[model samples]
Target chain A: MAKNKRDGTFYINPYLGGVLLGLVLFGTYYITGRGLGASGAVKSSVVSAVHTIAPVHAEGNKYYSKFLSDDASPMSNWLVFEVIGVIVGGFLSGTLYGRLKFIVEHSPKITGRTRLIAALAGGILFGVGSQFARGCTSGAALSGMAVLSASGIITMMAIFGSAYLFSWIFKKLWI
Target chain B: MVGPLIPMGVIPETWNNVIALLLGVGFGFSLEASGFSSSRKIMGTFFGYDFVVLRVFFTAAITAMTGIFYFDYMGWMDASMLYINPYYVMSAIIGGIIMGFGFALGGFCPGTSFTGVAIGKIDAMFFSGGLFIGVFIFSELYPLFQGLYNSHNLGGAKIYELLGMRDTVFAFLLIVVAVGMFYGAAFVEKKVTKVEY
Candidate 1:
């Protein structure tokens, strides 16, 4: 494995990583009958928070009410558990690779503060977009594509296409 | 035996969450090991410096799709029982555009960002906080976006059905297209000067 001089951690080959990911995804569908997701877990957390802080308000809202259930806590959802596992899994990988550290990763051209702001703003946009698209890159686009769903293909195209277009526009932030 | 064990009642419902946790571990480990925990590395696809995202994503998609098809053919699993995301023409495109903008700026998707958070990236934390706020805003103002959100509903439509092709045929073509893209990405990576993150 080739190590990065700065980080001292070696990254896996991309194609090999992809195959592993694909097998995981395949296994997920085989066992659970659904694809992997990330945004849904975040949505579940948001719903749980709102329900806790303002039950009346959460119940009053159509969108929030849809997720509010009497049987189980929103935080008790499968996606939530899955997200927790994601954190654990990520930590394990970091430990194995010696990539565990506290730092703001950014390009040299930009200040850490600038990078943080961009990350926040971008996350906000993704949050809003995931709702409209009904899923983010993983849930809607990738998972959807795996099943040959029209929604997944279209969303995937739109995401990559728009990102390619906007990357050129937001070139200063990155390159 | 029919597949989709949980949905088909082959796997007990009590084990659902446990399975979710195990699967998520795999999902997270794969993403992080692929260097998806880094925003700059993820952004490489857009910059022509690296095509890891393209390679991983397409490869995953095709591999899963192929697996499902094979399972269905062999009568090992019932593919029809699988869940499919509904198509809302306008919202999917519009939402995807917004996410694309976010990707350009933030450089990490929700899944990847969580992996970043695990590695102690402060920026990922803020980005996740922003996700909560964004979802809150969207919820609070759901009425304003309701019309567009519910406008076009094509319920669980398959790509092959829409294009008038058989699933096997479409899957084969997709594999071909994915292979082509992989080759193209390799070519592009060689031609472009590498940008060290």
Candidate 2:
């Protein structure tokens, strides 16, 4: 039904989708001994790019140095590969759902430019936050919750709690 | 192989990236198929228009947690061997707060943003680009935040242990909480005016 009736809300049942995602996560742990991640991939990319452009600076920095190692290129990391797969998978799904299109999704009240600026700002914040938390929603929050990690639960609460409060403050962004 | 095939040497290390790719496919498919490609849909969880994010997130967490428990109980795998991110008190909280702020502004987390980009959303591309800039800024300013970043490291601490409760008990409570939230979300969704995304 979700596939047939095509509109903006074209999607599978939320509960079913959740189960499928959970299974993938579970399989990831069973096979890899760790949870899925998103921000880590981006972090790695930043590190690798910086290292390539300004080798000495990347090495000198405490944070970038932490991720850089002698044995492998930062780009040759697990998260990087996983992220590439994520892109491929998403493309496949988009094609199947006939949802692939180049458009800016924005509130009717706001122009596309405003939406993009907000998105860029949001990305920057998320990027910084991911570094601080050592993960993002998927890595620290969801995956962490699955394993019952203390930091995971605390971080999860902080993210959702803060987001709930902030969403009210920025209600115009959505509604 | 008991589990965590790569780490346990049941599977060779070379297959690490290969496995990561395969699993990522599943992960991406799940998120996109669930409508995570739309930032509006994700924002709906907070605005109360659609509870898809809440429903899917809690359900997935519960399902995986339950699977881990059952597998460990049956001795099919060792849960302890699984890598848990070290619990850094100050940084984790601060990072989450900052990220939450971003979520409201950006309407997409890093994972979901990638899914958005996958579906050819121009906004998602900008968001992803911003992610790079943010990471660069943090890396450049790492010195100022170094003290806060490395401060309070509780390595791989489990929540149940910290709460001084049995694992099973804590897990049961979490499941109850998730189920309760699902009902609450459904109730809230009914009251809120639906927005066409």
Q: Which portions of model 1 show Cα errors greater than 4 Å?
A: A1-8, A70-76
Instruction: Fill in the DockQ of model 2.
Output: 0.86
Residue runs of model 2 more than 4 Å from their true location after superposition: A1-8, A70-76
List, residue by residue over B5-83, the lDDT tens digit for candidate 1. Answer: 8888888888888888898899999998888898889889998998999999998899899899999989999999888
Give me the candidate number with maximum TM-score: 2
Q: Give model 1's share of reference contacts.
A: 0.84
Write the residue-wise lDDT of candidate 1 on A80-135 in tens digits: 88888888888888877878899998988889999999999999999999999989
Give the worst 10-residue stretch by lDDT in candidate 1 chain B. Answer: B1-10
TM-score of 1: 0.96
Per-residue lDDT of model 2, residues B26-86, tens digit only: 9999999998989989999998988899989989999999999999999988999999999
- Every prediction: chain A TM-score: 0.92, 0.93
TM-score on 0 to 1 scale for chain A of candidate 2: 0.93
The TM-scores of all predictions, comma-separated, are 0.96, 0.97
